[model samples]
Target: MNPAVKSLADRIEALLPQTQCTKCGFNGCRPYAEAMASGEAPCNRCPPGGAEGIVRLAAVLGAEPLPLDPERGSEQPRAVARIDESLCIGCTLCIQACPVDAIAGAAKQMHTVIPDWCTGCDLCVAPCPVDCIDMVPVTGERTGWAAWSQAQADAAHARFLARNARLVREREENDARLAAKAAAKLAAVQAEAPENDAERAAQERKRAIIQAAIERARQKQQAAQPRNTENVSAAVQAQIDAAEARRARAGLTRPGSDQNANTDPEEK
Candidate 1:
């Protein structure tokens, strides 16, 4: 950027209300100022600065003052955010959305506004999960710069710059962490890949070892259980032989046996 153009942009930025509200269709007051300095944007887009803001910008840029575009929004009284303590869900959305870090609280805890730090940008209003926030009018009919002082605007601008710096730093840190994690994941996937036949064979051998272990375990279990041989004692075998002989003789007694011992002799 040319030094002349940068100087002109700084002048335009100084004329701004420093709300950093982005009501000018740009990201912030500095962007709108730069756009105006470069002849890309009109000098009357800021609603927070109102008519006086346009005049200040036009003086700096050597252009005629224009009315604030109604499409953007009309100049209104300075307002501050008020949270209904009872209705607050403590979502912390407002805290994250606050460009000035004006809202203070943790998640699941009630948030309160720092009146001195609040820029009244209304950026936090939309992000509230619960309809607990109210934009209360602080300066009744005192609109534009009259409702806001130069000291207040300067302080707000300082806070806005700090907030933007903090956001950039955090984003860079988060991106670095994500990149590291992705690299680690890629390395892990590569490590798990089989580089050659040797690696694949090693894996196969490990599987075989596990399978052999399972088979051995099964055999050991079978060996540990009792098994009946089904062999009868000598006395029991003798009894069986005698029974079979008697059946074969058809109720006839043995040759040396007493007649009284064989009760079925009558049948023979």
Candidate 2:
């Protein structure tokens, strides 16, 4: 913000309740105040401040007092949240949802609210999954500024700013860690270099060994088959047939052909 606008915004911000409830449609009271000072938004949107807040804003800006915009909300008693520990499932949703970080707990652990830091914004109640959180009235019969003091509002605003800074820092750190891990994983994948010359040579040797073994097996199978009858010489086959004919004519058994049958047992 420029010095001129900042001065005006600070003046406007000083009058707000700093609920940071976003009821005014901005993220927090400072943004709402800045918008009002910039003529972008009206001064009566804060229900937490009620009629008095509007009047104060109007007076500082040198404008006519406007009625509190009922569309935002009606000003009433301030509220503080309470946690039913018995019902809490330790989801930590309420802790994450608390704008001021007034609720404290880890994931899967029960949470409790700090009364001193509570802004009565009721932001943390709805996000509780188990319906364990409740907003109870803290200032009954008192409304707006009467319900909350300026010191408390200022303190809440400070805490809100601090919480915002802390969240941003944590998010940035997590992003950096994730990026580094991704880069490391990518490097690891790239490290598996392509096959070297030695590996290629070893593969070639194994292939040659396998092929030689297969050739030997094929040759062995061919050698086991019976010799073809056509491979015998024609002259030799004719001579053998003639010899068999002569033997038959002589009433003699062919050589080496059923010799036991030709010899009688009485001859022994």
Candidate 3:
């Protein structure tokens, strides 16, 4: 490149958004800068740079007014590159796409975005196989534009740390809130649990009493029957006796005995 064009290239680079978004039909800000300096490309080629870029370039080259290139993207408010961690495959496509080397990671490794260096050009969005890259608007406590711009490359780095810290604090607070809610729910359920042991014991005793009454009634009916009918009762008794014998051999219980024994004849 000629020295005059190189000087002009430097001036053009200063006016660019430096996002390397490729809306200007070039690989990065520098490439666009070189093209503009050579007069081969127009000043309106950069959408990220917008009208300001056109004005700056026209001033540098003493050229006439030109409309922005319609093929390039429209100028919208500034935003930054964001990685959708869940969808990101870590292919490093975005890393290669960045003009300022704003993305960091090895091949096949989870990639992180360098927010400070990101120009929000949307260049990295298309290259991602997983489509994990997005351009998200910057939010938080507001600061002056001049302060943000003048801070140089290092300022971008500091902003990144601040953003991360805010996110971590938010997550921690949310986790604590959820944990407290779960603990409170558990405590409430425990408080409502069955508390009266005497009631439960009474129900069990009533069940046993009913069972005994049924057995006694059956025995009484058998005893009242005629001798011919006694054969059926005898067979039933034999089955009961066999079952009892098996239980006794197994040491499960004494034959023909209940743990809550009926001592009185009426009870039996």
Candidate 4:
């Protein structure tokens, strides 16, 4: 985006509810604001902003104020998620689904919502298997921007960004660990000397499989590494292509090559 457009998007984003909710048909408020700044999305998609929010957005964009799009959702009092501990099944699906890290618990353990942290995005409700989660209205009779504040929105946006960064870091760490283990296994296998041609072929096959796994893990880790820009370097792309070819070859190896080699001719 150009500087002017980016500035406009910043302003538009600042005026949003920062719910990180997907109700606007976009991934989050930032994306929706960018779309509006670029004229891709209309200003009335945010139900959290309600009519007043639409007016604010329209004033910013020099467009006529429009009513909230009912297709997105109707404006309602500010709400927060509540988990019924009695009915809770201890699944962590809600925790993973929460965009702002509002839900807290472990696998096979009852989860609780941190009301202060919750943006009431209604993101966690759908993922609950036991249907223990509920959206309880907090600001009764106060809906839309009237029920929300800029400070709350800013805090929610910060938490949403932090959660995303943490998830990426966790994934990259896991991929690194997997790649390390595969590399160690490959080295150990290579250290052993085959007694004969059959054993040598089997060892080679095992090494190939391990190498392919390591390559995949490396690629995954690289992709998980957050960057300001995208696109793999030419050298890295070439390495990936080579690894893919090796993986394909490993898959195409005769299914029973090792067994066939070991079996006696009479048994065959």
Candidate 5:
């Protein structure tokens, strides 16, 4: 995304309802905004935004206003998902489907929606295996931007972004743990002294296997990590520098560093 298109997409995303609903044929409002800014999608596909939203988008893009696309969906009064607790059967499908994390419950426990946080996206309705969720209209006849507030949209977007960040952090942490384990195993293999040529050959093979595992784990962790290096805070950078310095002084390679470096098995 070039600077100009990204700027346009940012403006477009700000105007979106931030429902994170897939009704627009995109995963979320930001992706839809990017598509629109790139001229790959029209501004009328968002039923939550309705006719008024199309006007706002047109004003931003200097394009003609379009009516909300009927094929995508019809604009209706805002609603919230309500789970029939008696019928819930503790499946938690609705919780998984909700983009805003509005549904609260665990597996084998009844799920309930926090009405205040619900975006009325209807995403959770279809995923319930027990057919216990219902969309209850909350905003009478008001629809689109009229029914939704800028504060609400901002809040929803914040929660969506936070959820994504947490998931990424969790995955990266898991990968790091696996990488640490593999590195430990590699160290253990290297510490095993060979008593004969055959034992030396077997130890070498084991070392090779452990090194490969560590490499794979490191690659996965690297891929899972966010690529926002430019946004690192000064304090965080200082901490990282200190940690690297410590590693250098300790005569121990970083977990992912020098996986294939040769050293005597008993050097430690």
Candidate 6:
């Protein structure tokens, strides 16, 4: 690549979301940038970049009127990536899919999205079998993009430390809450507990008696039920035969079945 073209490509890439969603019908932002610079690819290929990106590119390149390529996708509201911790198998598929390397985690480790780095490409959402990833808009008091970006970077850096200052504060607060809850729970349990040793022994004896009664009742119920092993076995065998016949009709044979029906085992 020529230095001039490379410089132009870098500028174009800077304007892109870097999500690497490939909505542009190219491999990634760099390829799309190169194509656009060479006039082979249009400026409207990016959906995540939206109208803002189009307008910016147009202004830079002094291009004529062009519509956002509908074939690429539509410009939706800005969204941040979120992972449903419950469904996430931590396969690191999303991590690999992220163009910017916005997702962080090892295989089988819980992955988190860096909101600032996430381009809201929706690329990671599809490859997930568990459907755990979701895109959510930034709500509450709105902060400008520059500030948000800085804050996101700071957060990412903080995560590298053994104990982040912000996390330590949060942990302290959570620990206080948990400690209070534990104390309350202990009090409640103590109140409900038998008052004296004799009372505790009596309660244990009653529990034992109730458990024995329940066991006896279960045993009696089992004895009363008629066992029909022959009938059960016959039903199971019928199902197996039906399945085998279906497979045979479909040109699949059971193991050790005659490969050549014309050559009989009796002849051998």
Tens-digit lDDT track of model 1 for 1-268: 6889877877787788878788889977878878988899998889999999888888888889998999889999989999988989877778777876677676676778877778889998998888898998899999999999887887676566555544444444543444454455445544565779998787666556545544543464345421111133464345435434543564321121112222222235
Candidate 2 global lDDT: 0.69
Per-residue lDDT over 211-235 for candidate 2, one digit per residue giving the tens place of the 0 to 100 score: 5544544464455432112223454
Clashing pairs in 4: none
Candidate 2's C-alpha runs over 4 A off are 196-268
What shift in Å separates residue 5 of candidate 1 from its native position after superposition? 2.1
TM-score of each: 0.67, 0.69, 0.50, 0.82, 0.76, 0.49
Q: What is the Å distance of residue 190 in model 4 from its true position? A: 1.0
Shift of residue 144 alpha carbon in model 6, Å: 13
Stretches of model 5 off by over 4 angstroms after superposition: 192-210, 225-268
Tens-place lDDT digits, model 4, residues 1-268:
9889878988898899989888999988878988999999999999898888999999999999988888999999989999999999876778878876677676676778888878889998888888999999999899998999987887676666555655565566555655666778888999999999999999999999888767766675556554211233464345435533543564422122212322323245
By TM-score, is 1 or 4 better? 4
Lowest-lDDT window of 10 residues in candidate 6? Answer: 253-262
Distance from true position, residue 233, model 5, in Å?
Answer: 15
**Candidate 3, RMSD to the unseen true structure:** 34.9
- Shift in Å, residue 127, candidate 3: 1.9
Ranking of candidates on TM-score, top first:
4, 5, 2, 1, 3, 6
Q: What lDDT score goes with residue 15 in model 2?
A: 89
Q: Which residue runs of candidate 1 sit more than 4 Å off their true CA positions?
A: 179-268
lDDT of 3 at 94: 73
The lDDT of each candidate is 0.70, 0.69, 0.57, 0.76, 0.76, 0.58
Off by over 4 Å in 6: 139-268
Candidate 4: stretches off by over 4 Å: 225-268
Q: Report the C-alpha displacement of residue 30, candidate 3, in angstroms.
A: 2.3
Total clashing pairs for each candidate = 0, 0, 1, 0, 0, 0
Superposing all C-alpha atoms, what RMSD in Å does each candidate have to the true structure? 39.5, 42.8, 34.9, 13.6, 10.6, 27.5
Top candidate (lDDT): 4
What is candidate 5's lDDT per residue for 28-89, written digit by digit as tens?
A: 89889999999999989999998899999999999999888889999888899888899988
